[model samples]
Target chain A: MTRVHDMGGRFGDGPVDPSPEPVFKEDWHARALAVTLAAGALGQWNLDTSRHARERLSPKDYARFSYYEKWISALADLLEENGVVTRDELMAGQGAGPSPLSGRKLRADAVAGALARGGPADRPVDSAPKFAPGDVVRTRRPARNAFVAGGHTRLPSYAAGAVGRILHHHGAHVLPDANAHGRGESPEHLYTVVFDAAELWGAPERAGDEVTCDLWQSYLEPA
Target chain B: MPHDHHDHDHAHAVLPPDPALRVKAIETILTQKGLIDPAALDEIIDTYENRIGPKNGALVVARAWTDPAFRAALLEDATAVVAELGFYGRQGEHIVAVENTPEQHNMVVCTLCSCYPWPLLGIPPGWYKSDAYRARAVREPRKVLAEFGVTLPGDTRVRVWDSTAELRYLVIPMRPEGTDGLNEDDLIPWVTRDSMIGTGLPGRPE
Candidate 1:
């Protein structure tokens, strides 16, 4: 489905104001980010799961909230949905008892270590890549509201059905569509496909410009 | 239509709903549940705020400019090469370093979400994560570049990399001219945050 979160190339976004700004415009933004990260370190869900949770909001809420605000709200829902915390306790602003998952909590000294040794998504796969660097490919075009189980998809809406050439193979990685759901880590050969900007936007004047996207094998078909 | 006048769905919405207060409440609840460590949150915030940032990326660019072998290593295997310099972490896994040339200029964006090399360039800028950038960078990069005051030559091919998967992209912007006499350390100041992101070029040597 072309969810609100996937709004690439949907016009009327207006000119980008690339003004210089601080990392966190407000103090709460930092707290919100750190809290979300710390809670995520509890081993309750994976990165893809967190991303899906953020995308689960209603169309109205998703459009209204700020970046970190969405993070904070999604985290609250995940904490309850994953059974890490109870809704009643969250409403009461007090724990019913002692913290259950003490062993999994990230401590202060270990924060840097955890951030350094990131959760690597690359896994061993028994299959070889089907396409090479020079092969031409076309992205899978799903009908609007018809996608892979209606879960998280890395293929932006704009690239659907667009033709491009494989620039390089990025090795087999976890397929987010399956991983975001409860399905297993279905690995797929990922490749960088380069598309001419003119072809992407149907503009003849922009012939020299190009755009490259990192796509999984399933999202492409030989052209 | 007016049955639910108030936001009864999110109980907190009934409150003032101030972002700061809302975050404080969530942190308090998670702390009470023992799911989050307050100290860890502080550490994560402090580390990103002060310790890690664009300086690390600038240093990497400087080393690449001074050492051809290092630049080759970077383009070949950025994850391993950057790790050798003690720069490796979350949101930066499986990096691909694309160099910018006069013939083709490279820029990076995440149309799906905000996926940046945090260990190197730190948190993404506000504009980088905006809806406008995510929507337009992949579609009309030349126009986007012009808005950033980056007026490229008419012939230079603009290559926009829309980061969609686990692999993060880092643009090796072309080194500024007239800085041939500078050392690696001296070259560090020439690199800026936007330069690495492919939005703005590095400043001239002072």
Candidate 2:
């Protein structure tokens, strides 16, 4: 059985220092330590509490990997279990070996298996598009400190109630998630949302400056 | 699917990478004797800082302090307009200037991820992305600032801006009046990198 979890070692509760000053000077050891810590945060995805979450993973791997390494590991595990790839193949250092998996037409099932196996080179197109360019939108502000369900969303806590306009639409990208329900997420449109200074800071009384931001699809709803 | 069991209101899409040429490029770079190292340094580079980090922001901030109107434009749409000064580059894309005024002060955070104005500021300082900084920066910004040795008057509201991929931030520190006739080129020295990051304000002539 895979190890379910470890205490996340240290630094789990929060930052060790509440008032730690920004180190203006560069330090390699600090960067190494930070990169190591970042790996741990990503590792927690394996132990996610959702029903759709993945099972016990190797603690050794968890403790030693980088952020990207963790992502590659989780993805590799999911794909193998789903018959997307064979153990020998992955270990043999053979990639999913360039598409067209056994002459199967690329579609929902194939793409799904490929994603589980690894991922399709070109991401599948999203069927449902919530908002379009020039749409007036408001990012939903859920009650603070409440744990919402599902994927790792790009929506920031501070931007919850903020309103803005959709400037441009960027096609779908990865939905950083591990929940079972979220496993099927496909590429969707990303929007560049522009907000006026007044709306965010209650009118920049002096210069009346404006601020704009880029937001992924899931973060907005029609105002 | 009318009365859905799940909230389909939000959807997720995972875009796979192009494994062909991209990986080859990454592999070549990684295999290079002394190119880029998440660990070791390439001899050609003194430290990663000069090649890609804070020095970039420091240069811009230094220039802004010297030039008043340019500083004004930078405070405006830093991403779109700052190019006029020939300081445009990759990392500073979508820059927004947060002003630290007598009435209020401003700071920045990338709570969700380490999104920063890399072109202008260079690489983000490690502490900026710490969980401690993320949680405390907003809840107790005044306290956080004080720790950085920036004690603000109670009257000044310290605003904290969280940077995301969609937007980046730069800080507009108050100009020190003592350096009255200093031209833009001469004024660059006073605008330290920290001032742009909103950690410390520019010091007045001693």
**Per-residue alpha-carbon lDDT of candidate 2 for residues B1-206, written as tens digits (9 for 90 to 100):** 11112222211011123323222222232223121233322211222234445555655666666667767777766765655544344335446776777876767766554556655665566566555566455445555666677776656655566554435677877777787787665666677666777767777534
Candidate 1: tens digits of C-alpha lDDT, residues B1-206: 11122235554443236778878888887777676788899999998999889999999999999999999999999999999888899888888888999899999998877889898999898889888898888877778888999989888998888888888888899988899999899999899999999999998656
Looking at candidate 2, what is the lDDT of residue A189?
A: 58
User: Please, what is the TM-score per model?
Assistant: 0.95, 0.52
Identify the leading candidate in terms of DockQ: 1
Best candidate, lDDT-wise? 1
Over the stretch A13-66, how does candidate 2's per-residue lDDT look in tens digits? Answer: 354243433333423333332222222222222212221222123444434543
Q: Where does candidate 2 stray beyond 4 Å?
A: A1-149, A157-223, B1-47, B84-91, B204-206
Model 1 lDDT on a 0 to 1 scale? 0.83
* lDDT (0 to 1) per candidate: 0.83, 0.47
DockQ of each: 0.55, 0.09
